[model samples]
Target: MSTFGEINEPSSRTAWEDWDDIFVTDDFLNLRLEKDVDIPKEIDTFIILEGRYLYDCVRAHHNLELVNSNAEVNLCLFKTKELNNYVCMIRDYNLILSSEIVELLKKYITISKDVIAIVTKPIVEYQVSELVSKDYVIRSISSSKQSTSNLDIHFPNLEQPNIISGVSAGVLCWREIIDKPAVAIICYMEHPEEQQIQELYELLERFKIIPDIAKFHRDNLFNSNLYI
Candidate 1:
């Protein structure tokens, strides 16, 4: 299994690369898991797991018992190195969690005493908007057509500042409302933090989901389809 690269179609390859960077980074781990636990499963999967990481692109291993694939959670974070009793972990760090993603995760994740989850996407995504929209991205090394086992997220060929202003565009836009503690998940899917953050703040201000992202990590952020 080959990791996404500068093949004939670099756009797609680049998109995955951006996702790869975000998915495997320490900061991303915090944003997705909303915890301080250092996910020690990967350190350059490209170098450590190599072939196995590439195989992950298929993303066919949907069963939590099979591998680290789950549908129910928005999967801002995960860890799966072992198999056949493989421990596929999930954490919903978004301000307002996604119901679909949660349902999907539950479908495949093999439950045991160790299985765990936390937070809500609807609550999280809605709260962390200091600007109109910020990109929320993810990618896998598997060859499977489906990125995740469910509507985890979609790869859009749109421009930057893409539009994280959808359903989770802050609590005001959300249909069903819940006032859970707003969780801020940092996304480096853009650039020029000051500028990007300004735009995002404006967007959220309108909706009143202005984020309190006083502190965050910024490294390996990417442009939109320009890289894709």
Candidate 2:
């Protein structure tokens, strides 16, 4: 039998507009996220969206530092903000390896404040564990550093880790702004990390950032990060 329809198959070209993987919306954001935060490399930008030129737009705003040139690939939200909401199961999960795309992002995306500074390799979990285990790292990095100033970071439309991390951060920030009256949580469809989000909020609250909503969603209906 033959059916006559456009057959809205997944676009082999791109997927940034994917509706299946819905996170938070701009209105939901309530924050003016109109500004497209950036990464340093086009490959890093499209590393999740599946749009090559998209991240080229990212590089124009910031630089995605290449931590290691040898690993498979990783996306690092170094000193940043935005739902950038990306997800990282391991260290070398999603990274930009396309040299051409890298060049384009370098050429187009540049921002006044570097938000999402990415890396080419996954974050070293062992290193992070060591930092967490270090008394100096935790004590010196404490928010009570009288000279420390607050920074409001912004993530792109992302909603997994990058965006989720920011949202959780914002809520905790709000807590201090309002004196710890609120906090939040974020989650993914396949994986909901409530305890993780709460713990994250708790940690940030110590820094005086009131917390709010702590849940997120992801459908992964896209074909690849290069197009979506």
Candidate 3:
């Protein structure tokens, strides 16, 4: 597995000096697909959830069928029954993907519209009063390299000093390089709070990407005595 920095060479050092690097070695990621998983030839939206909390929250609410899996990752699909809008979910535990895997993933999905990636950042990292008051704040950065009309309506653009790394960053960088459309939604929160999870659900629902389901299974998982 090759690192992103190695595979995609930057045109100039000064331009990418602030960008974070992805170091992918065999030791860090051992991806092995047990079975051949068929991905849809075309996709309306491809959603990637990085953190464990977000993955569990979405898995709890959506009846996602496992398409592929291994030790580090779980690939699932959520298709709307009526509209037939395909939403592919990649629950990446380690938040790293090789360039070959990234290309292979993009080759099949062939997202016609948008690629949405949701990742989390610690609230302590930022000093914004809005995050302190709201308990969580969702900001976005798009591949367009310019303000997106639709996304700007919902969440503000992610500012400087905050960089995206790992799988989400790799995908976004690839899309930007190819001039395709992709957006990374960064959620800044202290912990896995119900309010924050619900806000995420609402955001996905607004895009008509996820299904409506019963309560999240966070209570059972988070409050369980097994961890204590």
Q: What lDDT tens digits, residue by residue, belong to model 3 across residues 1-228?
A: 767666565667465543468665667454555567665666666666677666656665544445554444565545644443555455554444645456546654355456778887787775553435766777888877543435433578887777778777888887798788788889888766444456677666655545653433454444456774
For each candidate in turn, the TM-score is: 0.18, 0.22, 0.67
lDDT of each: 0.27, 0.26, 0.62
lDDT of 2 by residue, 164-204 (tens): 22222332333334332212222122112111223323333
Give the runs in model 2 whose Cα sits over 4 Å from its true position.
Answer: 1-98, 118-125, 128-150, 153-228
Top of the candidates by lDDT: 3
| Overall local distance difference test of candidate 1 | 0.27
Worst 10 residues of 3 by lDDT: 145-154
* Candidate 3 local Cα displacement, residue 9, angstroms: 28
Listing every candidate in turn, what is its Cα RMSD in Å to the true structure after a full C-alpha superposition? 20.0, 21.3, 8.7
Q: Model 1 Cα displacement at 88 (Å)?
A: 6.6
- From the highest lDDT down, the ranking of the candidates is 3, 1, 2
Q: Give candidate 1 regions above 4 Å deviation.
A: 1-79, 82-97, 108-110, 116-228
TM-score of 1: 0.18
